[model samples]
Target: MSDGLPMRVPAPGLPARVRIHEVGPRDGLQNEPGTVPTEVKAEFIRRLAGAGLGTVEATSFVHPKWVPQLADAERLYPLVSGLDVRLPVLVPNERGLERALALGAREVAVFASATESFSRANLNRTVDEALAMFEPVVARAKAEGLAVRGYLSMCFGDPWEGPVPLAQVVRVTRRLADLGCDELSLGDTIGVATPGHVTALLTALDEAGLPASRLAVHFHDTYGQALANTLAALQHGVTTVDASAGGLGGCPYAKSATGNLATEDLVWMLHGLGIETGVDLGRLTATSVWMAEELGRPSPSRTVRALSHKE
Candidate 1:
């Protein structure tokens, strides 16, 4: 056995401490064509909480024209507000921020894309313009005593704009950090990132004086590389990760983008590595299976599939 600092050997294992932010309720349902009823969304959140997830992306405050599924943010937030968890809502601009604050959102996430093409597609604005727009929202949210998390989407690659420059990622990250946001999440939006790319990017950030504690990694499993990328980040000392239950969600804008790294799959990897995710893998698996049945699709989590087969 190895001694001190829980190092991941060539063989598989869990990390020492792992924090999973469940995004199934928001990210998982956002891209689906059919609008999931608010009650169903609340039920998903309830199951996740019962499964021991501490942080959940509960909803988005975008207008109905953009993401009609989350138009019921106001309706859903109050229903689950009393839970013992952090419910982070994604706010697109000052209007979104105002709505979140009015509803008493404790924490919020502001998003920016590292690639110009994606920024244009997702936000209908350039990278710089989107950041400029969110500046006041971040300020106002902070003024309202809300915690802000910054999302840097397409950190690794963009469909229209090939590989994103590390410098661009750094610039966006710094901008968010300087704007008084609490944490920054680097998203492998299209799931094109590999282990080496993760290491390179994190290392560059470290070299640039950005500590890992204030950072999280959001990865998609499009190329089936999400777990590998998670391990790479764990080895580099990342403590927090973003995942969805049942491997739900895909980018409506990114044609090739797939669902996020499944929470069950990520928890399986973390538990194997001795990481404490405060999540029950068995319960999470059951939840994913149930969700798949609810969605009328096959479960996307490899770990869930394997466990179900064994039973």
Candidate 2:
């Protein structure tokens, strides 16, 4: 939206407000090679919400062996439990759910891959097997009065399989909806999606009985197309978008995958479109800059860099 291109009017029926589901803390830092101290992760979540992110993914309940960076979920969740934001944790299974419940988590997310290769590599199970494992986890979380979000990874393409069929994504989406997931996030994990691909997939899913309102688009910026794909999703009536602060995190199973779409970049586009996100772009940019400093690297977001230079 900010490449000096002409801005087209949003199609009719586009939502006036878009909810940004910030995944920087959980999905972003989980893959960092060096361990971020538990306290630092907690502070990062606080800063994200302070920047007006209403929903912040707090941490993952995956075993430390799998993602050693987030093994401190217990210690980290309590630190931000009192915040006025919705903090959701990623639960891998029923055990993960129990761990989250014990810590007073009000929201939890379950993940399943759209491609068999990703499922086998990331979860060590077939796609169906992974969904079967999450069935009870979703039910238990909902019963406990916690909001359950389901994530379908590799919705557009897969690193191992390549060009995943739209049917596969639709089937998995329906299954997740049937499993009682309150919302489903369709992830372009390997970042091969173009705007046309996004429009086609959303149209197919809508025809398959999955409403665009119940779906969020999660894209990586490996191909520099995340924002364009997001615009496509918005025109099709998607109201929730998942992004990471400082464009953090990538799929470990996706060797070609880069960082998730930056929250600051999304905010810039949303604000430019006259869409209300309740997020302060200046504060969000500052948070990402601080995070980049903490990570000992340059901020990956173009918006953040431009804003920093102006400052």
Candidate 3:
């Protein structure tokens, strides 16, 4: 899709190395019932780093009232500061960015929805306005020497809107790219995307002139298509992915939504295919087990449940 590059499919093997951005610490805890204590959150990050994840989304800097679970972001940030891994936090606005900057965050992420209805409902703004909101935040983050990652949620389909246009997804991603975001994560937030849809979207993105190296894929398993869609993206040249440990988080606003693609499951598949994620399987499993115990519930990862049965 780029100039002079044949958009042909990749060979039938996984890449030698892949980067897993662990979102279990932040995205996983956002939907849980009780507020996970700062100590527990810090331990969670430590455990994830021990599992060999290079990048971990530590916490969100949103208002406490909006998400009470991550209210102690200030406390949590400093606790993970000494870790060797890249710690990124989600900053939704100027206030959130201020908090993150105070915490000495080296990386910050901002999100926008692809569909108009989802954008208005989730961010309380239209698509264009939501895009506009991140311009200043991206600028400020870059000014502070922080790497900015942008997320385009519901890139495949929206529950209320259904069947999003590829052109719209491309436009939003391009805008985010132009805003100086170092990486742009394309998210199937509701997990309604299939392999065909995934490939088609990547093709469209490639044609739209967005560099493949700057893109990452985030999928949910609502329809059990997360891994299949990921494989499709891999074949199309995606190296970074967003997955939650134990498949922990789902959007509270979407009644039909399910948890994200489990990190344990993704790592297992990558290992089986001879791909290197640099994650310790046993430690990753232990982290999921800890989260399950903290929440007093079963893990949503099929691989976790299956592996637990053997032990």
Q: Tell me the spans in candidate 3 whose CA falls farther than 4 Å from its real position.
A: 1-13
Q: RMSD of candidate 2 to the true fold?
A: 2.5
lDDT of 2 at 262: 96
Q: How high a TM-score does candidate 2 get?
A: 0.96
Q: Count the backbone clashes (under 3 Å) in each candidate.
A: 7, 0, 0
Error of 3 at 301 (Å): 0.6
Of 2 and 3, the candidate ranking higher by TM-score: 2
User: TM-scores across all candidates?
Assistant: 0.94, 0.96, 0.95
Better of 2 and 3 by lDDT: 2
Using TM-score as the measure, which candidate wins?
2
Q: What is the C-alpha lDDT of each candidate?
A: 0.88, 0.91, 0.88
Residue-level lDDT tens digits of model 3 in 68-142: 999999999999999999999999999999999987898999988888999998899999999899999999999
Q: For residues 186-283, what per-residue lDDT tens digits would candidate 2 score against the true structure? A: 99998999999999999999999998989999999999999999999999999999999989999888887889999999988887777889988888
Which portions of model 2 miss their true places by more than 4 Å?
A: 1-13
Q: Candidate 2's error at 151, in angstroms? A: 0.3
Clash-forming residue pairs, model 3:
none
lDDT of 1 by residue, 37-78 (tens): 898888889889988999999999999899998999999999
